[model samples]
Target: MTTLLEARGLTADRPGDEGPVRVLDSVDLALESGTLTELVGPSGAGKTTLLLALARLLPDARGSLALDGVPAEEIDIPAWRMRVALLPQRPTMFAGTVAENLRVPWRLGVRSAESPPDDTALREALDRAGLSGVALERGATRLSVGQAARVALLRVLLTRPRVLLLDEPDASLDDASAEQVRRFTAEFVSGGGAAVRVSHARSDDAADRRVRLTGGRLEEVGRA
Candidate 1:
């Protein structure tokens, strides 16, 4: 498969009371189309930082990143973001009905109506994310943490991004919900897109290649 995303010598740091604290250093990674890769690490190991950098949400230090054979910096940020979607560990939902929140992107004109997915597509996406269409018409603020996460995932899927970046998406789910997340991720990649997941679960089934990050560096972990 062809490479969908690549990062070379990526690094990040932030100002601290002591000095600059390095979050990521000399990180190199490549993700292929139609594959799901996992970045595993302990807390504060820069897994999220790496994901943000790859999504073009954070600027890296002294490295190059490319998406779909084009330099990341050369692409329009908003367009790049449309192609690469990020689902943060804590997703924010607007104060409205779940369907309203799901339709927020559309209402904001972020997505064009000509290509709008049908109701069945939306329902299927919600179902695959372990949510029912009923939740769509309910109040978003009333959803449990896991339900919120599922809604976030479904919302991103509606955008039809070519690359999906997930940060600990299963952290708040039960076993059954987690399994549904795993299945949906697998199916997403199987459909010719790519995903990079940051997970701590020992038995995650969504990754094909796994890498471990430690002390600001990354090393390949065995196959998933």
Candidate 2:
């Protein structure tokens, strides 16, 4: 498989009361097309920092980041983001109907209408996320925690980015909803996309690789 993203000597830190708090330390990792890499770590292990660094969302991050052999800095922020999106742990929903929330990306014109999924396509995506029978015309704010997470995942899928950076997407989900998320990720990688999931779950579907972090450091790597 071709490498979709790569990082080397990636390091990061944030301000602390006493001084600087080391978050990520000399981390090295790679994400390939058609693969799912699970990132596991204890709390405060800098997993979020690492993902933010890869997404170029961290200003204090230092090191090299590349996408498809191209330096990330060389790619325009907007274009790069379109290709690589970060699905935060906390799903954000606009104050509107579910359909309106999903359509916001298209309405903003940042994403091409011809590329995004149409109404039927959106419903299918929703169904795949265990949101089948969901009324798109209903208020988005009415969705529960798990439903909101799944909806957020579906929304991102509409953009069809090459890579997904998920931060504990199933944290607030039930067993069935979590399984839906797992299946969604599997199908995504099977379809030529890649994903890096930051999860605390003890077990999950077979992953191509497991990147484990300890005390903000790369402790070990478990390969399939």
Q: In lDDT terms, which candidate is top?
A: 2
Best by TM-score: 2
Using all chains and alpha carbons, the TM-scores for the candidates as numbered come to: 0.92, 0.94
Off by over 4 Å in 1: 59-62, 112-115
Over 4 Å off in model 2, which ranges? 112-116
Candidate 2 lDDT trough over 10 residues, lowest sum? 108-117
Clashes of each: 1, 0
- lDDT tens digits by residue: candidate 1, 46-116: 89988898888885465888888999779988778888889999978899988777776676555664365
Cα error, candidate 2, residue 36 (Å): 0.9
Q: State how far residue 207 of model 2 sits from its true place (Å).
A: 1.2
